[model samples]
Target: MTEVDLQEPRRVPARAAGALRRAAPALLAYAGVRALGLLLLAVWSAAKGKSPHTLLTARWDSLWYTRVADFGYGWEVRLPDGTVHSNLAFFPLLPWLERLVSAVSPLSYGDAGLLVSWLASLCAAWGIFLVAELLYGRRAGVCAVVLWAVLPVGIVQSMAYSESLFTALAAWSLYAVLTGRWVSAGLLASLAGLTRPVGAAVVAALWATAAVHVVRDRKLSWRMAVGVLLAPLGAAAYVLWVGHRTGGGLFGYLDVQGQWGNGFDGGLAFARFVGDKFTSFPSALAGLGLIVGVALVIWLYVLCVRRGQPLALLVYCGIVVALALCASGYFGSKPRLLLPAFPLLLPVAVALARLRTSRSAAVLGGVAVASAVYGAFWLNGSGPP
Candidate 1:
């Protein structure tokens, strides 16, 4: 009877492990946060008299993704001057996933994108939590996930953005690299590359970390080298294909991006734009605020580097930020676009971990409520500029 009693508690059977894996505590916490966020999204849509489904699938960039999934790629629309704009500009992984889901589920292409991104965001939160736990501790991991959940830019997670999906893959891939699971890291990094252009950054981080390990060991490791080689294939192949179709080299896709006002030369042009904004009282105040915000971002990077952050994390965050900030086009979306850069959460995570539970809960609660309201406002077109 005593043996039975002990075995009962240990009866977490091997087959049941799958369910437990899916019900990860971190994932549950992530879901609670995202559910609150979705509530805000719903309220905002109701106020605008826009169906959340439509908004999810029909918005600015979502439309492009849906068209790509529904009709197929290679369909181009021509401007008056006979210039062609193809949907090939966007990466394939998101739409491809959408197609796969729609084939097996009742969800439409647009809704599928929303579903995939929403789920992927939760996965990202879990992955980040795992990384923090591995590096710091359980408390730090929890804090990191909470910070990500209530981040000022949380609204993007519910949108049709690729940030969440890329982040999930990148975080777990980096975690795998740290744990010396080279093949797994390479696989996840490859998927990340398929998800977004910045995936190359993750690949670079992995390769760099592996190289350091190899050099320190003073011997060549085929596993590490193979992992490094596998990282860039997905992104590189897609970009090369885009170049072939667009009648240029890799520069062709970049040229197409420029036509959409997204040329990447350096951040000098954006700095000049912000300088012009300082000419008026209101603009000056706003510009000053923007400058302060940028400074905070820079300060966080400095803190991480100075604190002797892990090399992989530092490089990953640095490359993502540099690419986003230095990209000449779409200055307005810089903040939103850089949401996938996960390393920025480290300092805040570290701080939160040291706080007492009561204090941490109070702070997270306030941020959660405010984030909900801000998300609603953004959706309703009344949010901060």
Candidate 2:
């Protein structure tokens, strides 16, 4: 045996050990930081003249979800014209989980919301960590989970919102795809579609990846074709059902949103809405802040592409962001809605890993504390209340 042969054998185990060692520290740090953030959220919510218990149960979106689980989808508020403002418009998975938790726990429908989000967010964090670790290595994965835990939108993770559930499904679904677990990926993609209309983006990414593989090989294998074909049925079936029930075409969902003063074409029109805010000083500053935030989102997406992100993840995040932004309604929820696109967390995580360990930990810790404090205040109907 020559020197070159001995060197190859030595390098393999060394590399493997190095990877395991690098990954373990980041994983431990990620879990610790998130645990602290959650504790802060609970404590802060309690201190603000509100019961953290009630805050879990009584908030606006939480109420709707509880209503859906307690009753069923056909519940609606009607306008004079008889247009159905149905809670059915919301997807079923989160409410289903709420009902499941309530059945097993002593909690009310409201507290169950918190329980579900709390558990789901941790799962989401883990799924995201695994995906990031696979793509950019363990340090980036750790950073991604930490940043996600401290995001300004972190409050919603603790709310009854579907962000955590959606993130878990999307992240793991993508991971399954990356690992070529076709059936698991497709099943997850389908359920994700049922979770939110944008779950269609996950289905699309799955199908596209399979299709690309098929085309590359010049023949469609049954596993690949079936996996690609099966992914979108969940979203399509639900949306079409909404259309049938509402007596609108498949586009009835859009019409329903129109009733709420939302529709897709007007997002660009929102630039003017932001601009007109400048007529007042405080409003001008708010508009500037909004502009800055949107700029950051756009810049992050570009960074993902420039950093040579995997094609499937990039397309998945891109389509989801575009759909969320272009949708005709609920401008206020765009930030929260886009929160599940875990790919957006990647660049921020990469940046965090570059700082000195002490500095990075402090910066991330400070953001988590601030987010927790603000989240508490906001939930209490104080600042941004």
Candidate 3:
């Protein structure tokens, strides 16, 4: 049994009360940080004569999701350059949830989307804590949740976006894998795939771990085989359906992303995007900051590897970083895209766990305030796209 399973008499979440009590501290901290961010955003937006509620629920991708939820796909925006931005690019799971919530409640599509995101953020926090607590200890788990909460882009977690939903699914999936619950892991991974394209990372981790187990131990359970089979179903099903709809076969999704100027270009495009920043004097500092941020991400991944984190986490983190950093377009969205990569913060959390409670609390508190301010400023501007 794993560390988490050791003290537990049961593994399923049927003990909802027990699970909530165990995760209360981390969840509360995460909620507190997000609440601060929301409050700051409201104040900032009020001063600017904008609506914080609109920023969170009706802008950018949130609008696209609400569109998808309100009217099923086939909606396309034809650009001046003839490029087509299609609603088919968005996966179905989030919209589906929004629809479900709207059907059950008095909330409109945007409000339902916001409600779903808020609840998913809590689930993500609880899952992050569980994974960290299992790997290190409860203290490290709490620290990880707080650190994740205080991320400068952490305010995105409160928005009507898929990051929190996807992260919640991915984290719990990884935890299920670690605890030898292969079927549970695969099921969660499948759902995660339906949430975001990075869901493939979760499937990859599951398959890789299952492969390692089979090869090394020369043993495989029926559960393991079933899990391996189930891991990719969500993504595969959607991609295939898109292909069938567009009559482009398997490359339909790629065509959609290409029209959006997004793809895995091995960071060449991203490098050029950063390099262009130095051509002007004022933008050079932003470019430098971007470089430092990328370097910090790389450094943390290296630490996770050197520290011998579980293979599942390494695979998940590596793919997440690679995709977010290497995508050719939407540089501003990189940080938000990387939000679900909670594993990269585990090393930081583990390190912070070494400090005295008072010292760590002070440090995290200061950072939280800074993050809230930054979040307010970020959303008041062009926010995550």
**Per-residue lDDT for 85-108 in model 1, tens only?**
678778889999999999999989
Query: Whole-model Cα lDDT per candidate?
Result: 0.77, 0.74, 0.90
TM-scores of the models, in the given order? 0.90, 0.86, 0.96
The worst-scoring run of ten residues by lDDT in candidate 1 lies at 1-10
Candidate whose lDDT is highest:
3
Clashes of each: 0, 5, 0
Candidate 1 error regions (>4 Å) = 1-23, 77-85, 382-385
User: Highest TM-score among the candidates is held by which one?
Assistant: 3
Tens digits of per-residue lDDT, candidate 3, 1-385, equal 1233321212445476887788898898888989999999999999999999999999999999999999999889999999999999999999999999999999999999999999999999999998898788888999999999999999999999999999999999988887778888899999999999999999988888888888877899999898888989999999999999999899989888899998999999899989999999899999999999999999999998887778888898999999999989788899999999899998899889889999989999999999999999999997999
In candidate 3, which residue pairs get closer than 3 Å at backbone N, Cα or C atoms, i.e. clash?
Answer: none
Better candidate number, 1 or 2, judged by TM-score: 1
Question: Candidate 1: lDDT of 383?
Answer: 32
Off by over 4 Å in 3: 1-15
Candidate 2 runs further than 4 Å off: 1-47, 78-84, 382-385
Name the candidate, 2 or 3, with the larger TM-score value.
3
C-alpha lDDT (0 to 100) for residue 263 of candidate 1: 66
lDDT of 2: 0.74
